[model samples]
Structure formats: structure tokens, C-alpha cells
Target: MLNFLKKNAALIWAKKHVQKAEEFKKNAEKNQDELLLSLVDTAKKTLFGRTYDFENIQSVKDFQGKVPVADYEDLKPYVEKVKRGQRDILWIETPEYFAKTSGTTSGSKYIPISKEGMPFQVKGAQSALFHYIAKKNNADFVGGKMIFLQGSPELEEVFGVKTGRLSGIVAHHIPNYLQKNRLPSWETNMIEDWETKVDKIVEETERENMTLISGIPPWLIMYFEKLIEKNGKKIKQIFPNLQLIVTGGVNYEPYRDKMEELLGGKVDIVQTFPASEGFFAFQDDYTKEGLLLLTNHGIFYEFIPLEQYGKPDAQRLTLKDVELNKDYALILTTNSGLWAYSIGDVVRFIDKNPHRILVSGRTKHFTSAFGEHVIAFEVEEAIKSTVEKFPAQITEFHLAPEVNPEEGLPYHEWFIEFEKEPENLDLFKNELDDQLRKRNTYYDDLISGNILQKLHITRLQKNAFQEYAKAQGKLGGQNKIPRLANDRKIADLLKVYKK
Candidate 1:
């Protein structure tokens, strides 16, 4: 009865977020304007502010002129000073925690999270849940057990502040209301080894009333696979109350087919865009295809067109300047003290009124070995479109360029693990290649001009991706395999598991 009341009260408060969101979304420009001024007012006393002359900054143009668009490398010097217990270097307040994450070129990076900023992360997640509740007008799942497959909650001190993965850090901030409904005991959550952790999770949740699950799609796949392997039945059969799957960090569309297969049908999925730096957006409307930008959050946004990305005088555009369907690199200036920070993710605006966007790909994660810049969005779409015609069940896939093959010309190597292979593998390959060619004209030219052969498909054994991730000490949690790379580092590792 207490649980029932908690659900009712939580739903009532969550609806308030929907109402608040409606207010700002109507005037995203005004929200961003006020948000920027608030951020600037708080950060104007820092060392960075003095250097950039933040006090003199009056308009968006003035702010952009004062602060250059920066990458992690550009901001590393300031970050280093903060690690040595320096305050007011970036923001007046010291960071309470540093979220550690793997970097693309750099080995690892530590992102600061301030006391003032941390609550917004929690609220953003809550707001996402609330938005879903508002959309569906259903909170039936809240009374049942919920699980969020994440990294260990254990943290280490970095200087004076705690340091851990983004997910782990967020774990400590889960609201009191959710503490009762959430599952997988704290001791079970503390297991460092993912295999052992999943085993314990399977045991703990096997017979429980699991109504909702949250995690990256890949890790959830592992958990679902383990449960099905043990229980000898599908997920829905085991937990009939399951209603919603909250997923984020990576795109969920790529794994939709297999995830549905495991669940024995379709289920509601709410996609969110949360990172160590900030919670940027969440899927607000079920009918829409993209995430709604969080303008009222403490972070201010800037969009740099991918085409104009690397130029010396690249234009840093505001929300007012962005157009629909054009690729742009996302930048953030947060209360945590990152100034014009490049988060490395590419996005495309699908709606402008309320500012809804699709995460296209990463800035550095692209296949351009032969000057054909094939992005994650294009490749994933190509595969998704081809799968419609081929009717194959793909478990996982990765793409890398075989720049120097033994005999033939260069080509893209697609390592695919299929649960159910298409009846005609040759036809599937032909159709996929055709689809990609239609999408990326440069790739089409490369193939047509004989600069490269048709992409090669190396059929991988079941559990191939899982095995590869296991070998790298990144089997579960927020870790994700890059969809495409310019080199063979991942491709060579995956070769051993080819069917």
C-alpha cells in the first residue's frame, strides 16, 4: 500500500516537470538566453572568466568572441590544475566529483561535476521519466521492481573529490523514492567483475516483478541473454509486468530488432542523451523521432556545422541559426565550468520549434580512409534499410577499412554477427552495398571508380561482440564498440571470432 502511494505521488510530481518543460520549450530561444546569463553570472568570477573577460560579455556574440570553441585537449591544462585541488580556475565552486571515461585519442579523461550541476543531472533523468508518464499517462510499472544495469557504484578519491564512471557517479544520486522500487542489492551492484555481477543480477531478478529496465542497449542485451539462457523462456514470459525500457548513451535503433526478439515483442522505449558532462536531451514526444533539447538546464548549447568544423575561423552558431537535417558538432558551456566545450558528438536538428535532434555520429569516429567520409548515421541507416529487404536478425556489427588487402583493392570490412542469417548472403551483401552507395555519394564514387571494392561481410559467431568486449575488460556497463573506424584495431581483434 505504501508502494502504491509512492507511485501516485511520484506521478503527480513528474507531471509538473511536463508542465514546466512546456513553458520553456515554447520559448527555447528565451530559455537559452536566460540560461546563458545565469551561467555567465555564476562563472564570471573564475580565472577563466577573467582571461576571457566574461564581465564585458553582454550578448551571445560577445560570449563566443571571448571564449573559443574548445576540445578536451585544449582544456586539459585547466583540468590538470583542478585535479591538484585548485578552485576558481574554471568555476567558483569546486567539483564534488570527476566522472572518468575512456577517450578517443587520449587514454582517459576526468570530467568535473559541481554540487550545483549534479542535481540537474538527477532532475533531467527524473524529467525524462516524467515526460514518459505524461505521454502515456501510465505509471503501472512504478509499483514493481526496476533495474538499471550500470558500472560499480564504488568510487575512489581524486585529490579531494570522488572519481568514477558517469553511471557509477549517478548511482549515488538516485532519489529516496526510487530506492525502494530499484533492484539488484547494493552489494550485488558493487561487484567489479561484470560477469559475476550479471550472474548475481540474474539470480536476484529471476523471479522478481521486473516492471522497468534501464541501461545502454548492448549491456541490456547481455543481461537479457543471460536471463533467457537460465530461465528457458523469453523476458516477457519471466516478467509479464515489464512495460518500459529506458535506454541512453548510445543510439537504440541499431539493436531494436534483436532486443524485440529477446523480449518476444515490442515495448515502449524512451531514449535519453546523458553524458558525464551533462544531460543534454530526452525523448519527450512519442510521435517524434528525436530527443527534445534541454534548454532550461544550466548548460548553454552551441552548434558548429560539421562541414565548417576544422576551419581556423569556424562559425559557432546558436540555436537561432541551426536549420533542419544539417549535421552539427554539439558544444556546451556548463555551470561545471567547461567553456565552449566540444563534446565530440554530431547531431542533426529534426525539429526547430521545440528543438528536437537526432545524434548523427561522433566527430572523430568516421570511416575516411579513402577520403570517403562515411558517418555512423549513414552506415547504421544503410544496414537498417537493407535488413528490411534481407530479413536478417543482426546481433551486432562493426565496420573497418581493409586499406591494404592481400590481393584486391581496398574496401570496407563489415563484421556482422547474425542470429538469423539471410537466406541469400550474397543478395544481402549486394543490397547493403547498394543502399550505402545511395546514401554516401563519395563511397558510391569510390566503388564506381574502382578506388575500392564492395564492402566485405565477415560473418561472426554468436556472442562474438560479447567476447571481444570481454577481452578488452569492457564487457558491460556504458562501454560500446565503435560502429566504424578508420583503422583495423577493432577489426583485427574481431577476426578470430569470424564464422
Candidate 2:
């Protein structure tokens, strides 16, 4: 009976999702203006629409002129009103659910999630799986159990609106039949305490026929470690059928070596770009070029060049106008309440035909103290290159700028927590510095002029970042270590655990 359900469901879902992808491609090619106009027409009755004069908007240019690009801070006051039972403020109706996200700049944030936008979140994951299975030509992927390592499904009410982590809300909406084939049952997932939940997951999935696993990289590593310890075998030894691993929320390049090492073999990996605002993009192709932007998923997108990100009057480009291979700050007007919202993520387009993008980094996550602007994507690539050059495996890392009156010159400090320590620490540091120099011209110029000293490396104790996150009460479930900080706040915090 289970086999019958799995096979039939996979067939139905794959066919439906392929059609959706094709429609997305067609829309990307031509119907972007139509989609934008339709969204405005649908939202004109809402309070935000009225305030922004969505009724009079005739073209993309008109919409852009009327609505100001905004961050979460700008939307918070209206969200607060929605939380207090206000109706039709941003969307057609008051949101029945809110996704609570750990705001790095602000305090915690409650993003409105309407009924209309819920399917897009589920559809994003489904489309990703559909593309992967179709690419691998393996419909049997549905025959075995899959594990989604996510937050608890249990929810709380905020002024009559259901509220919880975004993943938790998605989990709660999973179809009953699919839930049967998912591991670490609802009870275990609701355990709140991450350490305890991990132990329970190990015990429950130890002997199950697990085929797929999905989560952020760090927590997934912890689970794999626990599995190895408990069963006295690598992941493949226990779950030989395991074929695919899905991850996001951080760069997977740094964790690839350790992950493959623990799994005991090469495995297919899929990267996704999902956030509290909306499900934006996913790895649709096998190649490592970039993620396919979902152009028609009840979300409209705008891009601002990174250079003009915070300017008083920055130019916003629609899909038709955006060029290939330029870093842009992503803005979204979703089916949910968020309008002209700057999602804070930076992306660079790699392909124009299908509109594929590589998530470069965050808008606030860059260093320019010495007039040498370095973004997080460059830092991540440098780390990956340096690790490959050496034999080190980095578990977690943070970068910060160091400037002291006593010291002769300022330099960037890297605090790295290594799973497998490098043989020659000095050589590793030099290689990393060289990789950064090759990647960023501005940084290289600074080094050549001797305006900036050589980069410094500080090896951190194992689990230093985990401990720090725990101390800050953000240990798990979408809370991540910021890869780059403008100042020494994160550096000073992690210095106590330096080796």
C-alpha cells in the first residue's frame, strides 16, 4: 500500500511540477509585466495598496515610482498593527499565521503569511525534488523515508494569529500521507531542545530505511556525527539507499569535505534559498552554476545594484532590465503582506536564459573600513579554496576587521573552528590570505600598497561558535553565525575560545 502511494504520488507531483516549471520559464520570458500588473490589481483593495496608489499604477516604472523599497524595519509598524487584529492592511485579509524569524539587526520579527502564499513554500520544495528526481531518473526516491531536520510543528498564538518558526509552519502543513514517510515523528520534532531532539532522532532513524535528508549544514553535521557514534558506522553503511542531501541557510562549500567524509561517499547535494518572506529560488540543475529563480510563484522581484543599495534614490530593475553577473540587492513583493521588501540577500545572476542566480551574500555583511570592500561570497570562496589547498576542514568561521592604536596597521582577523585541524597552521593562513588577494582586487591593492597588514588567523576551539550561539539563545533552527562583521564585536566574543 505504501509503495503504491509513493509511486503514484511521485508520478503525479513530477508531472504537475514540470508543467509549473515550464510555465515559470514562459512567464520569465514575457509575462513579467502582466504578472506585476495582476498582483497590483489583486492588492489594490488592501490598505498598503491604497496608500501606495496601486490602483493608478499602469507600468513597472509606475509601480516602482509609487512604492518605496523598504526593509523589515519599515514594515514593522504595519506588521504590529496586523498583529493587533487589523484586517486588510497589507493583503486582502488578515494573516492567519506569522513566521517568526530571528532578526539580526532588529529584535525578533513576525512576518505575515497568508493562505495564498502558503502553497508557494510547499511548491518550492516539491519543485526542487521533482527536478532532482527527474534529472536522476529515479522515481524510487519516494519509495523510502525522508527526513526534514526542522523546527517543531507546535505553534503559539500572537493576538489570534498562529506564530512559529517558518519551517515549523511548513511542517504543520505537510500532507498527512507524506507525514507517514517522514522520520523523527511529530513528537520528536517538537522537543524544542536541539541536543535532546538530535538524540531522539538518532534512536528513531537508526534502523529506518532513510533515503533523503534535508537541513542546514551545521546541524546536519551534528546529526551525522551522532549517527556515526551511536551505530558505529558511517552514514552510507547505515542507510545505503540514501541518495540526496538538501541544504541551505549557509554556504555548503566549506562543509562539503567533512560531509562527504562522514557519509563515506560522494552524494548528490541540492541547495535552496527559502526565507521567512517567501521561497525565492532553488537548485534546479545538476551543475553548480546557480539557482533557478522561480519567476511566477506568486512573487514579483526587483533588483538594485549593490553599489546603489542604500542610496536615497536607487534605480530598481525588473527581470527584463537586469544584466548578467552583477551583484544586486533582492527585493520582493510577495503574495503575502510584504510589499517592495528588501529581503537583505545579495545575488549575482549567472544565466540569463532561465534566470539563474548565485546568492552572493547579505547587504549588511561586508567590510569597507580600509576602502577595500569585501563581500561574504568572496570570503566563502576564499575559505573553500584555502581548505582545498590544504587538508583542513572548517566547521564554523567568522571574519572581522581589527584596528588597534598600538598595533602598526589594521588587518582582517579570521576566527575559524576546525573539525580537522590543518597540519601547518601558518601555511594555511598564508594560503587563505593569497586566495582572498586573488579574489578581491581592492583587497589586493591594499596589500600591495602596504596600507593594510597581512590577514591574521586565530584557530578557535571546537564548538566555539555553537557554544556562543547557545549563550546568545540562538543555538538552532535558522539562526546562523554571521560570516562577516564590520567591527570586532564577534571577534572579541569568540577570542576567549581561541586556541
Candidate 3:
């Protein structure tokens, strides 16, 4: 009776919001312009506003001229002031929370979430769920137990405001309606050790009616493997009602095959493009290949061409100017007071009518050792295409440049962990090389010019990535293996895991 009531209420909400979303999609361009002006108008009295002359910034070009494109380093001075309890340094008021982020390579950087801006993060998530419900014409998943595999919600006071991982901080804001259905128990989730937390999560959820499970792919893989091992049953058998999987932070294609294998069948996947900076985009249309870019959200975006990034003559374009399939460095001026901030992410538009995009790669996280800059999208797509022909079950993989080899020319090295490797490894490698070459012309030229050898693959033992993550103290919770690096830092560390 309770579940039935929940589903009906959710469906009603979905219908209303779905219509609003369509309206937003139709006026995306106008909405972006209005949002930009509104953000500037709101901050016109703040410290940054006075410095950038936000009052005189009447147009996009005016604003762009007033404020240069900024990265974290550029804003660090302002961020430091905010940390010292200085008000209106960036935003008008004090931040509601400081989302502490720790990447695999970088140290903790605190990203401010203002009271006005914070709701958009929560709303983006709620809107995604509502859209899914409306599209499917069902909210059955809400009726069953749902679990979000995330960080500990316990937060510390940073100066005066709340501080923790983005996921951890978001946990505090879970809607009252979801509190009843959400699982793993507050106690289990608070466990700091990821392995222990996963074990506890399995114990708490394996026997429940889990219909929707949400997490990054790598962590979910860990949870699924443990559950299967414990019961000697597929995930579907354990959670018969399980129907939906929500994923973000990383690409979903590489893990799709492995996840389906673990589940013993297919489940609906709703890929989201979210981060501490902002909840940017989410999968609204199941039929589409890319996520629907949120136009009405408190973010005004600047798409800088990937080639022209960081250059003085680089073009900065608004939504109307972006072309489909071309890579762009995603920059944001948002409600959080980020002004032309390059969040280091790269995206490509797949559709223009509603502006659906695919997260292509990161600006700083690609291989450019020999001027052959191989991106995450290219490598993942190449592997995806190669695996279609070769039949390989990839657990995880990473690529790094091999600058100094024992003998012969330098080459790109692939460290792959496989559940089921191809029958003919040599043929599989050749096909993979060909796929990569087709996608990346610089690599092909290097190979043709004999400047680099064919890419080499070092087969890694099972649980290699897991072991590597555990070694780094980042086994779970949003930390993903870097796709490619210019340096061999990760490659050298992964050498021991090679079979």
C-alpha cells in the first residue's frame, strides 16, 4: 500500500516536470542568455563583481572581455579569501557547504556550494529521476529498496560551513521520501574503509528487494562481484526486482558488458554527468545516445574548441555556436559564482535540437608524449569497437606512453585486466591497434613514419585495477583509473600486476 502510494505520487510529479523540461529544451538559447545576465546581475554587488565590473557587463562579449577564462589556479586567490570567512568574495553569502574533493593525483580542493546554488545540485538529480519516471510511465523502482553506494555522510566543520566529499555532502540532502526506501543503513555507509563498507553494504542489501542501485562503475563492480561470490547467484536472482542502475563520474560503455555479465541480464542504465562543480547533465531520453544538457539549471556554459584551448586566439562559443561531434573544453559561469571557469572536462554534442552531449575526456588527462594526444573517448571507443570483433571481457584498462623501452621504438602501452581475453591475443591486439589508428590520425602517422611501434598490451591478472586502487587508498567512491597519461607513473606502478 505504501509503495503503491509512493509510485502514484512520483508519477504525478514526473508528468508535470517532464513538460517543464520540454519547454526548457525549446528555449535553451534564450534561457542561457537570461541565466548569464541574471548571474551577473545577482553578483553585481559582490567583491568579484566590483573587480570584474559586473555592472557594466551587459552582454556575453562584454562579460567575456571583463573576465578572462579561469581555472582552479586562477580562482585560488578568491577561494583562499572565502576560506578565511570573507563574505561576497565570490558569491554574495557564505557557502552552505565546502565540497572537499580528492582526485587520484591531486590534493583536496574545497569547492563552495552556496545555499542558493546547492538546491540546483539536488534539483538536477530529482529532475533526472522525474524525467525517467515520465519517460517510462512508471515509478516502480521507487517502490522497491534503493541503495546509493557513496561516501560517508558525516561532515566536519570547515571554518564554519559543512565540509566533506560531494557524495557525502549530498547524502545529507536526500529527500525525505527517499529516506524510507534508501539502504545500506546510515551506520554501514559511515564506515570509512571502502572494502569494509562494500562488505557491509552486501550484507545489508543482498537479501533486500533492491530495484535501483546507484554508484560509479568501478565501485558497483566491486559490490556486484562480492555479492555474487557470497550467494553463488547472479545479481538479478538475489534482487529479483532490480531494474535500474544510475551511473556517473566515468563512462558506462567499458563496464556495460562486465556489469550485464555479472547481473546475468540487461538492466536500464541512466548515465549522468555530475561533479562537485555542478550537476551539469543527465540521461533524460533512454532512446538517445547522449545526456540531455541542462539549460535551465543555474549554469551558463562556454564551449572552447579542444585544439584552441589555452591559446590566446581560442574561440569561446555559446550554445548556439557549438557543432555536433566536435570536442570542446567545457567552461562554466554558474550560480556558485564560478566565472568562465574551465572545469577541466571535455564534451561533444551528439544532437543539436535539444543539445545532448557525451563527456569525451578531460583536458589534462590525455596522452601527448609524442604529440599523439590520445583521449579517453578515443581509447574507450577503440576498445569498444575492437572488443565487438575480438570478444574480450574487459574488467578495466589504462594506457600510458612507453618512452624508454628495452629495445626498438617507443610506443603506447595498454595495461588491461580481462575476465575473458580474446582466443588469439595477437589478432586482438592488431585489431585494437587498427581501431585506435583509425580514430587518432597522429598515432597512425607516427606508426607509418616508424617513429612509434604498434601499441603494446600487457595483460594484467584479475583484480589488478582493484588491487591498484586499494594500494592507492582510493578503491572506491568516485576515484577512477586514469584512461591515459603522458607519463609512465601509473604504468610503472601497474608493472607488478602484469601476468
Better candidate number, 2 or 3, judged by TM-score: 3
Per-residue lDDT of candidate 2, residues 230-279 (tens digit): 88899999999888898888778778888998999757899999988888
- Estimate every model's Cα lDDT from 0 to 1: 0.89, 0.87, 0.90
What tens digits encode model 3's per-residue C-alpha lDDT throughout 1-499? Answer: 9889989999999999999778989999988998999999999998999999999989999988889999887887888899888899899987888888874344578888888878888898888888889989989999899987668899999679888998888888899989998998999989999888999999998889999999999889999999999999999999888988988999999888899999997678899999998999999976568999998889999999999999987899999999999999999998888889999999999998888999999998899899988899999999999888977899999999988999999999999999999999999999999999999999999999999999999999999989998998878888887888889999999999989
Instruction: Sort the candidates on lDDT, descending order.
Output: 3, 1, 2
Q: List the pairs of residues colliding in candidate 2.
A: none
Worst 10 residues of 3 by lDDT: 101-110
Top candidate (lDDT): 3
Q: Candidate 1, 387: how far from true, in Å?
A: 0.8
TM-score of each: 0.97, 0.96, 0.98
Indicate the worst ten consecutive residues by lDDT in candidate 1: 2-11
Candidate 3 residue runs with Cα over 4 Å from true position: 103-106
Q: Show model 2 residue runs off by greater than 4 Å.
A: 1-5, 8-12
lDDT of 3 at 93: 81
Model 1, residue 238: C-alpha shift (Å): 0.2
User: Which residue pairs does candidate 1 place in steric collision?
Assistant: none
- Per-residue CA lDDT of model 1 for 341-432, tens digit only, reads 99999999999888999999999889999999999999999999999887798988999999989989999999999999999999999999
CA lDDT for candidate 1: 0.89
